[model samples]
Target chain A: MSARHHPADAVLADYAAGTLRPGFDIVVAAHVESCERCRRHVRLFEKAAGAMMSDLPPAEMSADALPLMLARLERNPPAASADAPIAPPRDTRSLIERLPVKRRRWLAPGVWVQPIDVPQLPGDKLYFLRVAAGIRGLHHGHSGPEFTAVVSGALRDGKTTYRAGDFIECDTEVVHRPKVLAQDGGCLCIAASEGSLKGQGFLGELIRTIAGV
Target chain B: MTPEPSIETSEPARELAPEDLIVAIAVRADRDAFARLFQLFAPRLKSYLIGLGTTPPAAEELAQEAMLSVWRKAAFFNRSRAGASTWIFTIARNLRIDAARKERSALAYAVDLSEEPDAPEQPDAIVSGAERDLKVREALKSLTPDQVTVVRMSFFQEKPHSEIAADLGIPLGTVKSRVRLAMARLRERLEELL
Candidate 1:
C-alpha cells in the first residue's frame, strides 16, 4: 500500500541535505523506504541539495588534502566499505530487523520502548515505541520537536489516524494523546524527539514519570 | 603525490566544468582529470563538513576520503543521474554521515524502494540533466532573500528549525513558513523535470 501521510517538505529537504540530526534522520529514512511519494520528493531535494553545495563560496583546505587523497587512491583499491552490508534497497524488513530488538524494555504495563542511540545525537533521543492493542498510550506535549514513523499497525492521535508508513511530526505546540488503534494488532513506531516530554495533565505526568521521555 | 605546479596554474581550469572533468576521469581513468576534480571540490567539501559541525582536521580527513571514493567510483558516475558536482558532493555528505553513525548503513537516506520518479501532469521527458540543474538554479533565484536565508540556515548550517528561528531573531512560525514557501515553489518548478 501507499502512505497516506508523510513528513513535511522541510523535513524531507533536511534529510536530503544530510543536515538532519541522526536521531530524526533514521525515522525519516524508514518512512522513505516505504513511501514512494516521499522517496520521489527526497530525490528532488537531493538534486537541490547538490546544487546548493556547488553554489557555496569555496573554502581553503589544508595544503596536504589533495596529495593525501591522491596517495590513498593510488595505493588502495576503492575502499571495500561500499560493499558492506547496507539495508537492502527495496526490502525494509531487513532494515527493521537490524534494530535492537533483543534490548527492548517495558516502560509501562502495556507499553514498551527500545532505545536506538545514534552516535551523532548523543544529546537527543530515538526509540521504538510499541503499544498493545486497546491501550491508550502517552498523552503529552513535546518540549521540542518529535517525529514518529509508524512501522507496523496504527495509532490515532485526535483527528488523524496514522497507519504503517505514516510519518508524524509534533512540535512544542502540539499536544497529542495517541492511542493504539483497536482494529490493528497494536502499534509499533520509531520516534525521534528533540528533547524531553512536557506532560500536561495528571495522566501525562504519570507517563512522563514512568517513560522519562 | 608529486607536486604538479602546472595543474595549479592551468588555464583549462577556467574552461573545464566539473561535469566535464568527471566525464574525463570516468571515460579514461585520467589522473590529471581526477586531480582537477579534487582541486575543485575538496576545499568546498571540507568547508561543508566544518559547517556541519565537524572539526577542521576531521573534515580534512573526510574530504580526503570522499575524493578517494570519487577516483575509484568514477566509472559509476552517470551524468543523467547526477552531475559531477552533485556526485562528488554526495560522496562527501555520505562520508560525513558514515563517520558520525559509524555504520555501513548510514547512506540509507539514498536507499528507497521506488526507483521511478513521480510523473507530473506535463511530462518533460527530453529535459537534460543540465537543463534540470538550470531550472533548479532558476528556482533558487526566485526565492526571496528571507526565504533563501532560512533555507541556507536549515540545510547548510545544519541548524534545527527552532535554532534557525532563534538565530534569525524570527518567530518559529515565520521560519517554518519561509521554508515551506520556498520548498513549495521549488517543487512546483522542478516537478516536470522529475
Candidate 2:
C-alpha cells in the first residue's frame, strides 16, 4: 500500500540531487522504495537536474583526453553479451533486516536498538528501533532534525498513525511521546537523527542510557 | 588559425540527437556514435563535477569513467522510458556518489537503494519519456529567474539550503520556501502540459 505520509518536496529534491547527508539519505530511501508517488516525484526532480546539467558551460578536456579514452576502450572492450540477466525481484525482508547491523542492545522488556554501521560525523546517529506492541517510547525532542521511516506495524504520535512505509520528519521544536499500536504487531523503524536526542526527564534519561542514543 | 578536424564538425552524425547516437551505439556497436556521444557530454560532466567541489583532475577522470560506463551500458538504454541525457545524468550521479562513499570507506548502500522494484506504471502517465523531458525543460522556462537560480544552486552546485541562504543574504526559511515553491510550480506545469 502507498504511504499516507511522505518526506517533504524539498527533502525529495535534496535526495534526488544527491546532496543529503548519508544517514538521512538512507532513511529517505527506505520510504521512497515503498512509496510510488514519492518515487515519481524523485524522477521528476532528476529530470530537472539533467536539464540543468545540459545547460552548463562545457569545461575544456585535456588535449589528450579523447586519445586516452580510446586507449582505455581498446584495453577493455565492450563485453560480448550486451544484455545482462534481469535481477531477481527483491525479497520481502524489511530494509532494516537487510542491513548489516553491528549489534543489538536490549533497552527494555519490549524494546531494543540496533545500530547500523554507516560512516557518520560525531553527534549523528543512525539505527533501528523495534518496539513491541503497546509500548510507549520516551518523550524527547531533537537538537537538530530527526527522520524516521516505519518498516512494519504502526506508531501513534499525537492524532496520526504512521503505518508501514510512512515517513516522519521532526524538527527541534516538536516534542512528543509515540506508542506502538496495541492491536497491530510490533513496529520496526529505521531512523537517522542529527545531534543527540533531548530526553525530557529522569525516566527519559534512563531510557536514553539503555538505548545509548 | 584553422579549426581541428573534430567529430563535432563531421557531417552525418552531427545532425543526430544524443538519443539517436545512443541507439546507434546499442544497435551497431558504432564507434563514431560513441565518439560523438563522448564529445558532447564528457566536458559538461567535468564542469558539473568541478561545480560540486571535485578537483579539476579528479573531475576529468570521473567524467571519463562516466562515459565509459555509458558505452558499456548502452544496451540497457530504453529510449521510451528515459531521455538520453536523463539516463546519462543518473549514471554520472551514481558514479560521483560511489566515489564519495569510497573516500569515506563507508559501506556501499547507494546502489542497492536504487535496486528496489520500480513503481508500477501509472495510468495517467501517457507521455513518452522524451516528451516528458521536453515538457520539463519548457516548464523550467516558466519559473521566475530567482527560482531558477536557487534550483541551479541547490541541485547542481550541491549547496545546502542553509548555505544558499547565507550566499544570497536571505533568511534560511526563504531559501527552503523558494525551493519548495519552484518544485511545486514545475510539477503543476508539467501536469497541465502533459
Candidate 3:
C-alpha cells in the first residue's frame, strides 16, 4: 500500500465535502478502503466539515418532524426489514464484491466491463474494467476527467504502474495505453468518467467505439 | 405564530453532546434518545439538502431517511473518530449521493456509503473535539470574504470550480486557488488545537 498512488488532496476534500458525483464517490470509496493514509485525511476533512456545519444558521423545521421520527421508530421492528440495512463489517475484498447489482457483459477477449447504474451520471460512463494479465488496453484520451481505482493486481500506463488500491485520475491532457502487468493475477478496476473517452489510432478507435467508455 | 426553539428550558436532555445520545441509541436502541437526535439534526439536514438544490419535498424525505440511517447504523459510530455533528453530516452526505443516483437509475441504491471507517489507522481524537473550539470558529471568521465565499460555494453549493467561476464571473483558476487557500487556512487553524 505504501507504494501505491493515492487520490489527490483536492479530490479527497471534494469527497469529504460531499461535492463529488456519486460515480466519482464510488471510485474514491474503493481507494479509501485500501489506503490508510487517505482514510486519516478524509476523517480530518469530515471534522472540518462538521465545524462548518455547526456554524450554519439553524433552519426551521416542520412541527411534525419529531413526531414523524417517533412514529417511524414505533413502526419499525427492533430489527427492521431488509430495506436499507446497515453495512456489514468492512470487507477487504474489491469494491465490485460489494455491488448489489450485476449487469455486466464482455467488451473484448480478456476484457469485461460492467456498467453500473448510477443515476446521477451519464449513462454507460461509470463501469468496472477487468482485464486479464498480458492484455493491453487501447491508447485513449478522455473528453473529461476519468478516475480509475485498481481493485486487485497492477496495470501500467506509460512509465507509471498502478497497483491494487491505487487511484489514477486522467483528463484531456493525458493520452496513454494501459497494459495489465503479467506478473499479477490480473486486474479488476472500478472506473468512472465525466464524459466519453476519445481514442487515438485505428485499434483504439475501434475499441472505444465498441466499448463506448 | 411559529413555535419557539427555546421551549426546552426544563428538559434535562438539552445538555448532552450528540455523541453521547448516539451511543445511547446504539447500545440500547433507546427511542427517546433517537427522538432527541432527530429533533436536533433533522431540520438542519433538511435545510442542507434543500440548499444543495434538492426540492423541498425531496429534501424533507431525504432528511427523514438520513435520520433513519442514523438509528439503524448507530452501532457503527465511533466517538474517537468523529463528533456527532460530523458523523451525522457524513450520513446525510452519503444519503445525498444515494438519493441523487437513485433518481437517475432504475437500480435500487444498495451501496453502503459508510461501510468502513474513513481511516484504517486511528485518527487523532483531539481534532474532532477541537473543531468545536471558539478559536476555530474565529479562524473561520478570519478568512477573507472571497475565501469564505468560495469555501461555502464548494461545500454548500456543490458547484465545481468551473461552475463557481462562471457563477461568480471570475476565472476558474482563481476559484480553484481560493478554495485551496481557504482549506489550507482552515486546516492549519484547526490543526493548532492539537
Candidate 4:
C-alpha cells in the first residue's frame, strides 16, 4: 500500500546514513517497508553517502591488516548465496506479529498497549497501541517528538486521516486527541516517543499515570 | 591454501574495475581478485568509519570486518542492483549499527534483518548500478557547495539538523531547508539523467 503520510526527507536521509536513534529508525523503517517512494528516496540518499565515502581521503591501515584479513578469509568460506538463511526462516507474519512484545497493559476499556522490545535511550519509549473502533484517545502533548506508524486500520487526528502504513510525527506543539474510524474495525499503531506525554485533561492524566507513556 | 601463480602477476597489464573484481571472486573464487578489491576499499572503509567518529583503532578493525563480510557475501553481489562502492558502504553501515547495538545491550534486540518483499519497481529503480552511481556523483556535483556541506555533515558526521545548525552557527530552519533543497536538486538531476 502507498503511504499518504511520510517522514520528512531529512529523517529519511538520516535513516539512509544510519544516524537515526533506534526508536525513530524503527518507526521510519516500518513505513519504508510499505512505502516504495520513501524507499526510493532512501536509496538515493544511500547512493549519495556511497559517493561521498568514495571521495574521502584514505586512512592508513596497519601494515599487517591485509595479511590478517587473508588469514581470516582462509578459514571462512563464502556463503552459497545471498538468500541462504543466516537467520531462521521468517514465517509469513505481519510486522507487528514478528516483533517481540514485552507485555500488554489495558489503558482503557477498548484500548490496550503492547510495548515493543526495542532498545532506547533512557527517556525514549516505543510501544504499540491498539484501540478499538470509535474510541477517542487521550488528549496529550509530547515533551519531545513522537513518531507513529499505522500497522493496521485507521485513525483520525485533527483533519487528517492516517491509514495502515501511514506515518505521523507529533512535536511538542501538537496537542490533540485522535479517534479510530468505526468502519476500520480497530487501529494498531507503533509509536516511538522521545519523552513522556503531557496529559491535558484529568482522564488523560490518569491514563498517562497508569500507562507510563 | 595451495600456492598458485598470482592472477595479478599473470595479468599484469589488465586492470579490472571493482565491479568486475567482485564478480571474479563470486564466479571463480579468485584470491588475487579479492586481494585487489581489499586494497582498493579497506583503507577507504576505515576512513569512512573514522569520519563517523569511530576511534582510529576501532575503525580499522571495523573496516577489516566489513571487507571480510564483502568477501563472504561476494556471491550475493548483484552489480545490477548496486555498484561496488554503494554495496560496500551498506556492509560497513550495517556493521557499525550492529556494533552500536551490541554496546548498548547484551540481549539481542529483535531488529528485523530479513529483506522485505520488493515493492513494484518504479521507473528509476531499473537503472543499472554503475550508471546510477555515475548519475548520483554527477547530481552531487550539481548541488551548491553549501548544500553539499549540509549533506556531508548529516550523512558522514551523523549530526541532527539542530546539532548541525548549532555547529555552523546558523538557524535550525536554514539547516532543514538546505537539506530539503539539496535532496530535491539531487532528485531532479537524477531524473534528468533517467
Q: What is the DockQ for all candidates, taken in turn?
A: 0.41, 0.42, 0.33, 0.46
Error of 4 at B63 (Å): 1.1
Cα deviation in Å at residue B33, candidate 2? 1.3
Task: Rank all candidate structures by their lDDT, best first, as comma-separated numbers.
Answer: 4, 2, 1, 3
Q: How well does candidate 1 score on lDDT at residue A146?
A: 90
lDDT, candidate 2, A91-163, per-residue tens: 5564555666878888877998899886665778899999999999889888889999999999999999999
Task: Kindly list the per-residue Cα lDDT of model 3 for residues A29-68, writing each as its tens digit.
Answer: 7787567677666666666676676666667777887787
- Between 1 and 2, whose lDDT is larger? 2
TM-score of each: 0.85, 0.88, 0.79, 0.88
Per-chain TM-score of chain A in candidate 2 equals 0.90
Candidate 1 RMSD to the real structure: 5.6
Which candidate do you rate higher for lDDT, 1 or 4?
Answer: 4
- Can you give the lDDT of residue B152 in candidate 3? 70
Which sequence of candidate numbers ranks them by TM-score, best first? 4, 2, 1, 3
Looking at candidate 3, what is the lDDT of residue B122?
Answer: 44
The C-alpha lDDT values of all candidates are 0.73, 0.78, 0.71, 0.78
Interface Cα RMSD of candidate 1: 3.2
Best by DockQ: 4
Residue runs of model 3 more than 4 Å from their true location after superposition: A77-93, A100-112, A117-120, A132-136, A182-186, B1-11, B23-36, B71-76, B103-145, B180-194
Over B39-128, each residue of candidate 2 has an lDDT whose tens digit, in order, gives: 989999999999999999999999999999888777767654566777788788778877876432123233332333334545544344
Instruction: Give the docking tier of candidate 1.
Output: acceptable
Q: Write the per-residue lDDT of candidate 4 for residues A23-73, one digit (tens) a residue.
A: 777788778767778777776677777777877788998999888999898
For model 3, report DockQ: 0.33
Colliding pairs, model 4:
none
Give the alpha carbon lDDT tens digit for every residue of A40-119 in model 1. 77777777777777667777886776677767766855422324553245443545666544367877778898887555
